[model samples]
Target: MSTETPAVRVTDLTVAYGELPVLWDIDMDVPAGKLMAIMGPNGAGKTTLIKAILGLVPPAAGRVEIHGGLYRDQRHLVGYVPQRGSVDWDFPTTVLDVVMMGRYGALGWFKRPGKRERDQALTALDKVGMADFRARQISQLSGGQQQRVFLARALVQDAQVYFMDEPFQGVDARTELAIVDLLKELRTLGRTVIVVHHDLQTVRDYFDWITLLNVRRIAGGPVDEVFTSENLKLAYGGRVEFLQRQAPCDPPPDAPDLGSYPGRIRP
Candidate 1:
């Protein structure tokens, strides 16, 4: 690893979709070799921020610099693992096949992956403890297994900066532990790992730095310093109280009557 400079730099970043602003006046500096977590409530623009950095979503204003250069200039140096729900599990593909796709960006327009690419994919799968399932159909895997495959796919990219969104969601405790260990190894190798995480209880244990966002950024710094009651209040102040009187997401069929609460409940 070259370790030349900061992994990512954002200045006055504002993102909008069809004229509706989602993020505003965002300025951040992320150094290399740290595990940084983007923490926020639902609809807080965490995913939008990641997409903007990856060039998947264009920013309305401000600039993004990667490795001390323009985004396009450093595109190859970044890897991404989007939320698992964003992918189609029904797609006909083997685990190895999907992992090999990560090499496509490097192979470019017309080139095909060869033995070296296959080897790299296999190595990535091994790192995530999914090498035995490489030949299996991706659709047949469990949620955690599928997540591991996606992580393997990103690892195959061999990028210095990795952006993962909700990788731990819907995963088992064992799988979550495995992922944290993998992230630790990546940090040891001087790679910058940025993750969008939701679980407030484990935020302090898993991340070195935290960025608290709620449509707008509240505070961002080390977990011990930034993950305060005030910041949590800013992130979920109104929604928490509102949601308390409501049912959790996707309530069960025989669950309590939501109408029993005082507030509104959708049919």
Candidate 2:
């Protein structure tokens, strides 16, 4: 494992909307080349955390660093995928046009995209299996297809670190699987991928690193180390009954054996 600086770092971070605090003293470090999941219940500031790290929303207090430097110094190295619901689907833009927007950061102020940029966009579309839909209007695509286009846009950015806010929302099972596969592929290519994930059942299956949040940092580390029942209770509170249902244990020895009961039938 590389002992170098983390791909993304946050320290003493605090965010508030008016006088209402959303995040408090948040601190996290995401290692390079790993797939990480930021998990919390609704209104736990998961989206706010990503926005603060990306400098989209100013932090009321604390610092955010990307690859050991300020976010402004490394803006081009970051890719962001906002929530699917955050965008206007009625926009009259083609899929290719949307993906090309990713190159705008590198194009600087107002330069038009050239052949090189087009080719890059096409390649990114292919990466996410959306090459055929390049000419389709954004509003015409299904929910999953639209998500893939946004992902393709991010891919064309060629960022070193990627932040996605609920990319799986409203997506089909196939699209969800595809997104997870793509995240793993990015990790193989040495890029860091962070996702705001809500499903607890898939946390162990999808992420190598996880940070539990509930207005504050509850736990963070490798999945095996930090994704414990105790930490889960702290992060999710009373909603942990699902874990109990999935847990395995023997019934009480004095309990009647269902197998011997006339009402009970074997499968």
Report the backbone clash tally of model 1.
Answer: 0
lDDT of 1: 0.84
On TM-score, the leading prediction is 2
Model 1 residue 57 distance off true place after TM-score fit, in angstroms: 1.2
lDDT of 2 by residue, 135-230 (tens): 998999999999999999999899999999999988987998999999999999999999999776677778999999999999998988998878
Per-residue error (Å), model 1, residue 118: 0.8
lDDT of each: 0.84, 0.87
Tell me the spans in candidate 2 whose CA falls farther than 4 Å from its real position: 1-3, 244-267
Clashing pairs in 2: none
Residue range 1-267, candidate 1, lDDT tens digits: 336567998889999998798999888878888899998767889999999988889899989998899989998999999999998998998999999999999999999989999999999999999999989988899999999999999999989999999999889889998999999899999899999987665666688888888778888877778877667778766433222222345444544553332132221
After superposition, the stretches of candidate 1 with alpha carbons farther than 4 Å from their true spots are 1-4, 238-267
